[model samples]
Target: MNRSRKIVLFIAISIDGYIARPDGDISWLDDVQGEGDNGYSEFIQSVDTVVMGKKTYDDVLKLTNNQYPYEGKTSYIFTRKETSTNLNLVFTNENPAAFAEKLKSEEGSDIWLVGGADLLDSFMKEKLVDEYIITTAPIILGDGIPLFKANNPEIKLNQKSTRQYGEFVQYHYVHA
Candidate 1:
């Protein structure tokens, strides 16, 4: 019997647990001194689908100056506003967790849950997230958009592994 594809939350967070600034600025991430691509290139290759909130979609576009990363992969953007699909991106107003459940059942590689806070919370609430690959940078934002907002279900994680890339620490965990 085959299991559903995994929904992995692979992200970097500040020491204070913020993923980005209030204005969606993630420039601080560029300062981290890490060896190689900090496992990003390898991680990206392991998944063929990306699930992200609208804000994260916008931020990636803005941050890349409209270059649009995640080139060879399919991306689903959860939003209330109307948006157009281009290339590998599909904009949808579908319920995140509901849609994700269907996607997980489909034949594919693992799915990457690229988050902003709200989307992560929804997946957390529904217990859809199967694994988490969090890379904690050495710097603290003090205040910003947190990685996990309040009211997320308390999940017990099995510590899979931990690796250090310079001052950055990468943690691998799976739901227990």
Candidate 2:
């Protein structure tokens, strides 16, 4: 199948390249100042689906009043542990790369690879990611969850755009 849909990794990381604290605390992000949603509203509007690691899903659930954050988007949680299904959330044990390839073949606006390190590793290993939209916050976590965890082959990226929102800098890159 032709994989026309772009798989975009949209995430926030510390200046030192950590997504969260070792204990999964992202409270540091609360201090970032911006006009509004810091471009997230526009980015989410272009996304029709979201793929995230189980840990990320769990963390989000804990942070958001026990509700799913991505309301209208079809959400897939990559996990080996069994989980009950919800209306918009699907828990799957399938290989991340294969599942992502299949998803990309379907007609959709774009797939948001909202993450945890391991899922990013899997996709990187299979070369499934097409673009990356990373926002770097000013604070640096000395040691924490690295943005790309798994040891995978190096991939090249071409910088497309960049924007600054207060103390944060957002970078857009396309696979090259």
Candidate 3:
């Protein structure tokens, strides 16, 4: 297993526990504005490395038109297929936990897994994640990707804090 000590999975979901729409689109989130001191932007700024799944990466690329926001940060893309890009992107040659541990060994900054269902499922199954910061929007999408798929193990989280910003409610959870 990769020996990363500091790892976090951060995301925003609908009240119904959907991270993205059935079509893998987050356009609904655009209108919400998800404002206030969710501390996510600040938290992401503190991290040095970000890990993501291939599908998640593709969706982000499509959404952003390939213009990634996190510049100068080391990002590890986990995929079985070989990918090529003109921009500076690191391909993780190791598994999620192992890759995270390697980053820690290199004195890497905090690691955040910004992802799709599969990668999150992998990390959760491995029990390598330390914290979860989830923002729940006021609206609900009945059908979409569940926060954790049925294949995922049961996780017990100790709620660290909850903040309300208008219609948005942010929750901080850590393994119990």
Candidate 4:
């Protein structure tokens, strides 16, 4: 078996494949009737690092009342702006696939792609995502940021497992 660190896309998306509303609002995912943490606590334990777009990083801070939730993990925030990089956050505009390839070769556990639409688009273009653990929320905003953009690179994945968390259905898929 190929034994190297993996980049996993672990996220909760809407039933219509929207990750957020057009305004980057994810408040709809705030309260879903789900089992204890909905496997989040367990999943977070498996990664030592996180990769996300600047907007995503900012969103986390807002949602957590300015407290960075990924405290102990190194966070790579992709950005073009010259934002203040402090503590465990590493802001960079490195090419996504190159950065991901380099990170995966290093000795570490899996990495979490805590996303916004753009970052996912970058990774998807190069097929850098190794696994997708998507939990689908029931509500749809009708018009929003879709999970995949039009003309995105096509990929094939094999369903590894399916899980139920109250009204949410989580699907685990590995690149095929």
Backbone atom clashes (below 3 Å) for every candidate: 0, 0, 4, 0
Worst 10 residues of 2 by lDDT: 30-39
Q: Which stretches of candidate 3 lie over 4 Å from their true place?
A: 1-5, 36-38, 83-88
Q: What would the per-residue lDDT of candidate 3 be over residues 140-162, giving only the tens digit for each residue? A: 88898887877667879999999
lDDT of 1 at 30: 91
Against the correct fold, how does model 1 do in TM-score? 0.95
Candidate 4 lDDT by residue in tens digits, 7-75 = 999999998999989988888887778877888999999999999998898888998999899999988
Question: Regarding lDDT, does 1 or 2 come out ahead?
Answer: 1
lDDT tens digits, residue span 1-176, model 2: 55488999999999999999999999989988765787899999989999998999899999997888898899999898986578888899898767977887789789999998888988898988899999999887899989987568899999999998877899999977
lDDT pick, better of 1 and 4: 1
Q: Model 4, stretches more than 4 Å misplaced? A: 83-85
TM, every model: 0.95, 0.94, 0.87, 0.94
TM-score, prediction 4? 0.94
How many clashes (backbone atoms < 3 Å, residues ≥3 apart in a chain or on different chains) does model 1 have? Answer: 0
> Which scores greater on lDDT, model 2 or model 4?
4
What's the CA RMSD for each of the models? 1.4, 1.9, 3.2, 1.7
* Alpha-carbon local distance difference test for all models: 0.90, 0.89, 0.79, 0.90
